[model samples]
Target: MDLAIETNNLKKYFGDIHAVDGIDLQIPRGSLFGVLGPHGAGKTTTLRMLSTILHPTSGEAAVLGFDIKKDAREIKKRIGVCPQELVLYPRLSARENIHLIAQMHGMAKKDYKERTDELLGKMNLLDRASSLVKGYSGGMKRRINVLMAVIHEPELLFFDEPTAGLDPQSRRVVWDFIRDFQEKESTIILTTHSMEEADDLSDELIIIDHGKIISQGTPDELKGKLGEGDILEFKIKEMEQRDEIIELAKTLDFVRWGKPVGKHRIVLNALDGLRRVSEIMDVVKVKMEDISVRKNTLEDVFIDLTGRRLRD
Candidate 1:
């Protein structure tokens, strides 16, 4: 298989802190790979090293078949990065900002001009293309940030929290843009705290925490790791009764495991959840505002592995 990225026990340290520790990865060309974790999980550091912006303390990596250490310049030429923090000139118009990046990449004027207009249209910013970035809303700036990174049409793209502050409509637009880009066989490495986004976009993903990959797999495969079971979630009418309901649920023979999901809610892993709803309700003995039965989700898999939500 042709690999776009290959890392062997990659490590990076900042004095006393080990930001990235011995992470091994093999990402194939034309694949959409996701890196997920909570804050301080080293996702950004790994991307920086692979992008040739930072040197690794130890181990080796190859980006687009070029050695990251010795061929840093070659790697940069083929990759685009949309960093976690927005990078846009507030005083520049959206068109100017994107055009400037394309020019720096040495693209032909005709090609970049056409590409810039197309990107602006795709991001729903063509109407505001001439407006200075300082007057744009947060979501608009984020869309422009993404547009600038992709204007050069690099073979590999790194998106760190690309939709961090986007509204639902804007997020959908960006998601469609990324999908269209990948349809052209571009390799994309994405790092995000949004479980739904990762589950939807990734062909395969790695969950990193404490500077190490804790789990890696397709969304379905990771959820399958929890084994066969339906999830029963009950929204309690009274917040004070949640704990008591959970304790009662644990004692039920039909329930495999029971735990609190969020405030006023308790979830149970059990077989035949739909048929056993009455039994579960009888056990909990609490007034529930709502009850839902569903299959395993990526968020569930993450919580199972990390003992916390992705945001935590």
Candidate 2:
């Protein structure tokens, strides 16, 4: 199999801080890959090194077969990056921003015009192409930021929190765009905090924490690591009852394990959760509310592996 990106013990440091420490990855060509972690987890720093924007303190990586250190320029030409923060000229119209990026990439005027128009149409922003970015909503700016990255039609794309703050509708639009791009056989590296988004878009994913890879697999494969069980979650009337609920849940025969999510919530792993719900309720019905049962999910896997919520 052809690999689009490869890293060997990739490390980056700022003084004594190991921002990205000993991460090894092999991303296949034309695959949609996800990197998931919380704030300060080095997701962005790792991407920066892979994208040739930062030099690694130690270790090596190649993007699209070009060495990240030795062939940084070549790698830059074949890759596009959409950073977590908006990077657009507020005074420029959406069309102009995309046009400028295309020009910088050395695209022919005719080709860029067509490409810009096509992207705007797909993003549903063609009608507002002439509007200055300053007048656009946050979602609109995000859409334009994405368009700017792909204007060069790069072979490898890196998106850091592509839909971080968009409304649901706008976020879906971006998701659709990503799907369409993948159909074109472009390799994409995505970093996000949204477990649902990662579950939906990634062909494979890795969970990173404290600058190291904790887990890596397909979504189903990762969830499978958690074993076969349904998830049971409930909220208590008082924060003080959380520990009591967890203890009660653990005592139940059906509960495999139980933990307190926050001061007022408890989550449990159980088989046949629906059938066991009545039994679970019997123990904490007086203190619990908003009880729910569902199948194991990526979020569950994340929490179980990290012992903390994804957003933490």
Candidate 3:
């Protein structure tokens, strides 16, 4: 199978801080691959190295078969990167900004004009295409940023939080746009804070923490790693009582595992969790703010592996 990206012991460091420490990856062609990590987990740093914006401290990597070090200019020509921070001209109209990227790629005027209108329509920004981007809302600008990245029609794309500020309706539009883009057999490397986005779009995903990959699999496979069970979430009124409840939860044989999530919520994985809710509640003996039981999700597997929620 042709590979879109390949890496071996990739590393990046800043003084004593090893930002991306010795990692390997293999992403197949045309896959929507996800890179998930909490803040400072080296997701962006790794992307930079792979995109040729940052030189790696060590290791070898290839993007679209071009050596990241030797063929950086060639790699840059074939890839589009939408960074976490918006990169756009405040004075440029949305159409002009996208056209500029197309121009950089040496696209014909007619080709860029037609593609610009099509992309703008898909992002729900065609009506605003003539307007200066500075006047646009955060979400609208975000959508434009995405458009600029893809205007060149690169074979490989890297999106670092493409829908950070979008509303539900607008977010769905971007999701649909990405889905449509992937259908063209383009490879996308995405890093997102939204688990729903990752679960919905990623063909495979890796969860990174402290510059190391802790877990990787399909979203369902990662969730399945937590075993068969339901999740019982108990919201405690008093944050100080979490430890006591965790200890109490350990005594219950029905509970497969238990951990605290967020500020005052304790989550437990248990077999037949719905039926054991009352018994589990009886054992807690705490001031309960609320409680609910639901099936395991990718976030649950993330929490179980990293020992904290994605935001934390």
Candidate 4:
């Protein structure tokens, strides 16, 4: 396979902190690859190194076949980076912001004009394109930020939490844009804390924690690693009873594992889940407010591997 991005023991450090510790990756061309982790798991640092915004302390990587360290400028030219924090000119109008980015990328005026108009229309911001970015809603700014990144139509794109604060409708629009890009054979690397977004958008994903990869595979493959089972979630009427229900679940032979989630929920991994539901429910029947059973998900895989939830 033709790899769009590859890294070999990539490491970055800040004093004693190993922000990105020895990550090796092989992302194929045209794949919507996902990097998932919690707040301090080095997802942003890793992306910064890949996009040539930060030089790694050690190790190496290539983006679109150009060395990130030695050919940083060349790599920058072929890649678009939508950072976790918005990087827009608040004083500029939305169209002006995109136009400025296109100019910086050395795009011809005619090309950029057409590209900008098309993107604004697609994002449903054509009517507001003349408005200053400082006055735009958070979601509108995010949408413009994304457009600015791709104004030059780069071959490889890096989106760091692209839909972080978008409403459902706006988020779906971003998702659709990503899907359309993938269909056109552009390699996209995305980092997100949202498991649902990762599951829905990623062709393959890696879950990172403490600057190291704990799990990596297709969504279904990662879930399969949890073994054959259904995930049983119970919402208790009283939050104080969570631990007791989890302890009771642990005592069941059919249950592989159980843990308290949030304040009122207890999640369990069980075999023959349908057949065992009644037996499982009987234990928590008195305290249970609601219950659900489903196949394992990426979130469950994260909890199982890291011993904590994704947001933690």
Candidate 5:
């Protein structure tokens, strides 16, 4: 396969914390890939290694056909990275910032002028092209941050939470640009905690936890890993009562697992979920103001593998 990125036993340690403990990855050319994980799950550290911003403590890796250790300079040139935090010059206009990067990349005189105008227009920032970045809205600044990363027209791109804090409309616009990039034949690797964004944008998906990959496949493939069952979610106002009820649920053959989600919520995964939902209510003998049951979701899979409780 034509791989855009591949890694083996990639590890990054910060003192006692094994931030990105031994993990392997392979992302193919022309595909949009997603890295999904909760906070402190090593997703960012892994991205840093792949982008050549941080060196791995051990293991081998490659990006865009360049070895991470030996060909880092080459890899850096071919890959564009949009980091989670904004790194823009507040005093510089969007165009000037992009033009400066283009010049640094040694873009030809005609090409530099043409690409700057083209990207600004495509990102819908032409109207604000001359305004200082300090005047831009959160969403607008995020868009420009992404735009600047790609000004050199790299073939492989990395976007770490590209739409993390954007409004729905802004997120949708960012998605549009991502779709356009796919249409134009660029490979993208994105890391986001938003299930909606991953489901909508990824051609393939990977989930990491505690510094290792727990799962990898197409979204549908992993969702298929779910046994034909239903999951019921309940938000409880009380904790011990919820646990007591779930303990009773453990005795039922139809119920696969009864797990408390938080201090006051429990989720039950059961066979023929809807049919047994009423029985669950009777079995638990609890009145929940809000109860919902549905087919498996990406979140359910995450919980199934990592446990239902919150991670610190």
Candidate 6:
């Protein structure tokens, strides 16, 4: 497999804070890779380092096989970074914004003209092409921000919270553009707080916590590590009742384990639940309607690993 990006022991320090603690990452060409973590998990910091905007405190990173330290100029010319913060003149029209970015990248007017128009059309901003960014909606501005990154046709793109603060329709538009870009063989590195977003679009997912990489693998690969077939979640009104539930749930042979979802919510892991929900429930002496059953998921894996939600 070809690597479009790589890092070894990448680290960044913000005074006393180790903003990006040693992290190793590998991204394959033409794949959509997601960097997922809670807010302040150093996602933006990592993107900045990968884009060559912020220098690493320690370790090595490369983009498109160009050493990030030795070939920053070439790397800058070949990659695009769309930060989480909005980056637009607000006074410029949507079309004008893309044009400004194109010109800054030293794109030829003849070449950029058609490419800008094509991207505008793809982002569904062609109709609003001339409208000043100041007058555009949050989603509209985000669409244009994304267009700015791709107008120059860079080989790799970095998107930080790309669809954040957008309506469902605009989010879908952004997703489509990403899908189309991948189809054209563009590699993307994205940071997102949305688990579903990562699950839906990423071929690979990396989870970070407190600036350190905690998990890295394909989505299904991580999910498969859950080690159980079905998850039974029981929400109770009181925490003191957990002892009774745990004692009752352990009587079933199919039940691998039963634990607390929180102080009051209990979760049970059972094998062959399709053949055993009734049997398990009988052992627990709880009504089937009282418990909720869900397949093991990445969310569960995160909770198990960190003892908290991905957003926490």
**How many clashes show up per model?**
0, 0, 0, 0, 0, 0
lDDT of 3 by residue, 251-276 (tens): 89878888888887888998899898
- Tell me the deviation in Å of residue 181 in model 1: 0.3
| lDDT for 144 (candidate 2) | 96
Candidate 4 global CA lDDT score? 0.90
Tens digits of lDDT, candidate 5, 79-99? 788989988999999988888
lDDT, candidate 4, 1-312, per-residue tens: 899999999999999999999999999999999999988899999999999889999998989999998999898888888988878999999999999989988999999999999999999999999999999999999999899888899999999999998999999999999888779789999999999899999999999998888889998889888888899887777767677777777788889888877666777999978678889778765556577888888989988886578996
**Cα-based RMSD of the predictions, in order?**
2.9, 2.0, 1.7, 2.6, 2.2, 2.8
Give the Å shift of residue 47 in candidate 1: 1.2
Pitting candidate 1 against candidate 5, the one with the higher lDDT is 1
Q: Is candidate 2 or candidate 3 better by TM-score?
A: 3
The TM-score that candidate 3 achieves is 0.94
4 versus 6: better TM-score goes to: 4
Best by TM-score: 3
Candidate 6 lDDT over 1-312, as tens digits, reads 799998999999999999999999889999999998889989999999889888999999989999888899999898888878789998889888889989989999988888988888888778889888999888888988898888888899998999999888889889988888878888999899887778878999998889998898988888788776787776677567677877787777777666665556777777776667777667766543467778877766666667666765
lDDT against the true structure, per candidate, is 0.88, 0.90, 0.89, 0.90, 0.85, 0.84
Residue 57, candidate 4: alpha-carbon lDDT = 94
Order of all candidates by TM-score, from best down to worst? 3, 2, 5, 4, 1, 6
Q: How far is 135's C-alpha from truth in model 1 (Å)?
A: 0.8
Candidate 1 contains a number of clashing pairs equal to 0
Error of 3 at 92 (Å): 0.8
Give the per-residue lDDT digits (tens) of candidate 2, residues 1-312: 799999999999999898999999999999999998888889999999999999999998989999998999898888999999999999999999999989988999999999999999999999999989999999999999999989999999999999989999999999999989989999999999898899999999999988999999999999888678899887777667667777877788778877777556777899898787888878865556798989988888877876677876
Clashing pairs in 1: none
TM-score of each model, in listed order: 0.89, 0.93, 0.94, 0.91, 0.92, 0.88
